[model samples]
Target: MKLRRFFCLFLSVACLGGIAQAQDDAASLQEVAQRREAQLADALERLRTLRNDIEAQQIPLAQRLQDLDAQIRERQREVERRQRIRDNQSVELDTLRQRVSDRQRELDYISRTLLPEYFANYDASLSAGERATAGEDVRQYNLFLEKPDTSETDRLQHSLALLRDSWAQLESRLGGKRYAGEALDPEGRVISGRFVQTGPLLYFAADQGELAGLAEETTALNATVTPLSTSQNAHIVEVAQAGRGTLPVDPSLGNALAIEQTRDSLTEHLEKGGIWVYPILLFALAATLVAILKIFQVYRIRHPQPMAIHDIVKALRAGQRDEAMRLARSQPEPAREMLVAAVEHSDESVEMVEEVMYESMLSTQPRLERFLNVIAVTASAAPLLGLLGTVTGIIKTFRLMTVFGAGDPKPLISGISEALITTELGLVLAIPALVLHAMLSRKVAGVMARLEKASVAFLNGLSRKSLNQKAS
Candidate 1:
């Protein structure tokens, strides 16, 4: 039994020691778990701090990326805007080039064609200095056309200057003025003289009585100066010296001067009409005078006193023979003579009275017909005289042609002018003379008709009075 108790005590001691060791092991494990919990808390706090730092860093980086993206989009838009500006600028440059080319072409045409043509027909009335200047301008214009270095603006400015200068020069020349110049005389000699210009009409007169008229040239450079006739020279010289003389003005400016230079004067033309014109003029004058006298005489005879015929008839019907005779005597000659013869033979028969009145009427008819034959003879003879003159002129023309062999036409023209003038004058005289003769004849016939009517009425009155006297 003693041995069994000792083993139990030893087992109990071993159990107590094992229980204490287990308790100690549990306390160490709890302490190790607390240390691991603190380490884990520290690690988690470090992770949170790291996450906050990363988030703060991520905000700046994201803003940087957004800024980069915005910059890239701006760069693309800027490229597109620059391209559009370049396109617009290219179109504008092309338009400017085309305008420059068109302007250049216009300038070339003016230089080549227009300027040369203007110089070709330059006014002949211009002075030598003005013409020289114009010629130089034309040469310069030609040079400008040939030169390639000249700009369009420079060429256009030059052309405008040339046109302005040409116009001013023309205006200065058109206004007429007096000047000193050399003129050509009839002998083809040059004479220094004073020149007078009225528009295009120019005249030159020297101190030595050398006078000439100038003619403009259309193609040549110098004008032709023609010497005038002696009388015309005197007149022109007087006008040039006195400055107030009746010069022969050309109504058509230069045209009349040109025509007059080729034709004869009026005085020379009239002298060529021959001596027959004088005879024609005399015939016309005489015929005119005779016609006027006959017309006056017939007019007087036709229109007598209005109351004389009625008074005579009433007095005779009332048996107042003396009063009736006095009234009849106051009438025109034709009626007076017939009434006087009837009154003187009042006691005679009607047939005797009628025979006496008819004798008086025949006698008065010759007076009324006086000078009519003369007018008729003049009208008939004027044309015959003109015909004779024409025949003589033609004969003279043929004689001149025979002598000159038809080579010189001057004498032929003179003879022809004379012949034509004589015929024209004859016709002019004959036409009026014929008209006057016809009028005078009609007037004389009317007077005779009135005389016959008065005579028949007087005869009837006489017959009635005589029959009443017999019946009573």
Candidate 2:
């Protein structure tokens, strides 16, 4: 029991030591908890201070960020706007390129078409003296055009040179210019001469002051001039040398000299009228001759005088048969013939008298109308002949065009002249023939009417005794 009691006492002492240690541990815990509470309060205050500082800084930062965002949007929009401008510029560049291409095409067309035609016409229109200096340039220009693969640059250069030269020549010549050149004399001798160029006319005055006249161009493009009258040559020499005399004044600007120089004579003009012209001229001649004959024949035709017919009727009514017959004889041939028949048949019935008068009229009508159908035929045929000539001329023109093309009008000139001349001749012949035919027909009708009136008067003037005797 004693041992058990000692163990109990020891257990109690250990238990009491454990309880004191536990109480000390609890106080240390309270102190540690107090220290931790103070630290927590300090941490909470620091957190509140940091949150206030962050809120104050964040306002300006948010405003700065929003401003940056707005600036970025503006820069993006500016970039888009610039891109659009670039796109428009690209379109404009394409348009410019297209315009350049079109200009190039136009240049090519001028070289291919306008240049050749202009040079050809220029050579045709200028006198040989004026064209002599330009021949080389024209030849070279034509060569360039004919070359299939010629560059545009070469063509442009040649065209500009030719155009400038032509313009300069025209400008200088229009106001009258003098130059030295070689010309062919009437005898085909080459002579040195001073050339005076005035518009389309070129005059060559010899250096020796001998031959002077208007300069003409040959098919070979040589300048040829024949001498004028002695006085005229002297005058032209004076004008060419001294530069003080008047050229022939022209009302048609400066074209009259050219026209006068190149004027075709009647024979030359007729020759240019081609093959159809011969027929037209023949018809015109035939019509003229026929018209003359018809005029003479119709104008000389005799018709009875009114007074002579009246006297015949009075005699017939007065029963003077011999007097009536003598009056009928005094009248002109056609009226006398008809009246003589009526007087002879006066004792017969009226119907029989009428038949005899009608027969005489029929006989006389052929004489009055003799060759009248020719005049009518001529008037009707002239215009038809002209139309035929015109058709033939047109056919010739087409044939020439087929062979020579329309580039040179000279080849076609003959056909055009023929067409126009034939039509003009036709109209001229037809109009006069128609007028002559109308006048002749009127004359013939007047003569016939006079005969008819005399016949009627003779029938009315028949004696009643003569009629009653016929009835018996």
Candidate 3:
């Protein structure tokens, strides 16, 4: 029993040793696992920190890229704006240059058309007249008496006239059929409608709203004035008389017909007084008539009772107050006004009297310049009216073209003709009106100067009389 008890004790001691060894092994494994877990956690923390840094860097990079793109877009817009400004400026400069070039070309064309060698000769002749008038004894003073050797010019004129007839012939062939019921033209010397055979003269109802006289007073002139014919002796007088009724209808014969038709149409239009040109022309005529009548009236007043300074001085020296007043009343214009004012200032001082006379002269000057503004207005407005008429005619022509597509030239040419005729007439009227305005203005100035001179002379006489009286 003691041995068995000793064996049990040994077994218990071995089991205890085994359990202790197992516990130590488990403790070592746990230590190794904890070390590995700690290292892994540190590595994971490092990776997370690196990921956050990368994300932060990406945000800044994205912002920088967006800012760079915005800068580039702004630069492009600025460049485009500058380019547009430059383009607009260039276009404006080009337009201005083109307008200047066109104006220069127009001026050149006008100068070339109007100024020829013959124009130079005419200018030289005019200069010669001016030189003679300026008291420079000109050699060409009698140029008007000397017959001008115009043979070449006359030949050219004759050829031009023949060419005009040929043009008329061609025009008649193209447009004569349209003008069947037209009246005769007084200026064109055409006999087409309303012909009346009087003894030697062939009276006709003309385009002028009045009867037209025969083309010529002499029978010999009638033969030459007739239109060209194609007979064997068409140029001969005898042939013209023999072949008057039996001649073929040459193209030249249609010249009169076409001209008469156009003249009749134009005359009918003008007589209607519907165009602006007609009223303008009537106004100009009325103005011119009034100006002429005023000129005649002024001439009558000026020539009959001219007040001379010497006569007035003698009257003042003689102390003939009643005679001076009578002379002043008989005188006209500035002289009468000055004398009346001077006589009214008998009790006044010499300076006061002189001032009164000057004031009176100044007041009369405006009266002398009466109707001058109207002339100036007419001269200035005439050209504008012409431009208006031209514009109207051009508009009418363009309107006709829009409707007709330039199919017929009659209406178009008629408008152009009216435009040209009215323009020419306006220029003609305006040029003369301007000249008359200048002349009248100069005359008024001269009259004012004469009145001032007379006033000065009277003042001098009064001063002399006062000094003499003081000395006495």
Candidate 4:
């Protein structure tokens, strides 16, 4: 029994020991689990931290990429805009270049062609200062054209300035006015005078009447003035002093004045009137003398104051036949002669006395109408002579034309002048001669009528006296 109880005690001790070891093992296991949990918690915390760091680094990269993308887009748009701008600028540059070329061509034409012709024709009309200025401008313009170093802008500016100056000068010259200057006369005398200018025409008048005339520019460079005439000097002076007088004006500006300067004298003009002009003048003189003599004869015959028909009739009615005859014989005229013939035949029969008076009238009519026929013939012949002169002149002109080949007008001028002047003189002679002849014919008719009336009155009175004596 005691051995069995010891074995149980040992068994019980073993059990106790195992149970304590098991409890200890359980506590150890619990401690190990707690350590593993702590390790895992630490590892999870590290993973979260790493993930946050990665997200942060990736965010910056994404922002940089977005910024880069935006920059690329903006650069592309800028390139497109610059291309458009370049295209527009190219078009504008081309247009501007074309305009510049056109302007250059216009400027060249003005410089080369127009300026030279204008200067050649109108340069003489400019004043001395203006001429010098314009000449300098032209010289510079020519230099600019010839020189390669001159800039286009500078050339254009200079050309514009020259054009403005030229236009101003031309305007002033065309607008006429008076100015004071020195003038050279035809007699080689220099005179200070007031000058009147109209375009190219210029005239000068001195304070004294001795120097006044038209002037022409002899030298363009020094503006030397030369006179055209002294013939109208006094008239020009009068006009200048009075502001209104018979002053000569150049109708053809300078052309007619130049022709007048070379015109022939009066004697030369008459000489050009040809040989027919002398006959025409002689006819005119003869017609004039005949007209005068006829007028005197008609006046004496038609209206004799002492032997008037009324006075002769009164003396005959009072039986003063001798006194009547004496009054009739006092005047030496056709009417007086007719009255004397009637008085001498008053003692005859009425028919015989009428026949005697008719014979006397016929004799006086011839004398009255004698020179009038010559005047009439001259009047008719003058125009014929003028036509003959015209024909002769035309023949001469044709001859000159044939000889000279119609090249020069000077050769034809003489013949033409002769023809025209002879015609003019012939017309002058013809018109007056015709008028005088008509007047003389009318006067002769009137004188014949008056003489016939006086002779008829005498015959009637004598017939009445003869009848009264026969009745007694």
Alpha-carbon deviation at 47 in model 1, angstroms: 16
Q: Which candidate leads in TM-score?
A: 4
TM-score of each: 0.56, 0.57, 0.44, 0.58
lDDT of 3 by residue, 1-472 (tens): 9999999999999999999999999999999999999999999999999999999899999999999999999999999999999999999999999999998776555443433333344333321112222112222222321346635445345434433543453354332111112232434454333322222222222333333322222222121122233342232222223322222233442355457645656566553322767756875986697578557644544521333555655676577877767766666775777777886674478999988988897787767777777777888887878778778778888988998778889768767756666676678788888888887777777777777777777788777777776898
In candidate 2, list every pair of residues with a backbone clash.
Answer: none
Off by over 4 Å in 1: 1-77, 124-168, 174-179, 184-190, 196-286, 300-332, 340-348, 351-431
lDDT of 4: 0.75
Off by over 4 Å in 2: 1-179, 184-190, 196-202, 215-229, 241-248, 251-254, 317-319, 463-472
Tens-digit lDDT string for candidate 2 (99-161): 999988887788777877888887666767766677767877787778989887887888888
Candidate 1 has an lDDT of 0.74
Deviation from native of the Cα of residue 311 in model 4, angstroms: 6.0
List candidate 4 segments past 4 Å from native.
1-264, 300-320, 330-332
Error of 2 at 292 (Å): 2.3
Q: What TM-score would candidate 4 get against the native?
A: 0.58
Cα shift from native, residue 354, model 3 (Å): 1.5
lDDT-sorted candidate list, best first: 2, 4, 1, 3
Evaluate model 3: give its TM-score: 0.44
Worst 10 residues of 4 by lDDT: 219-228
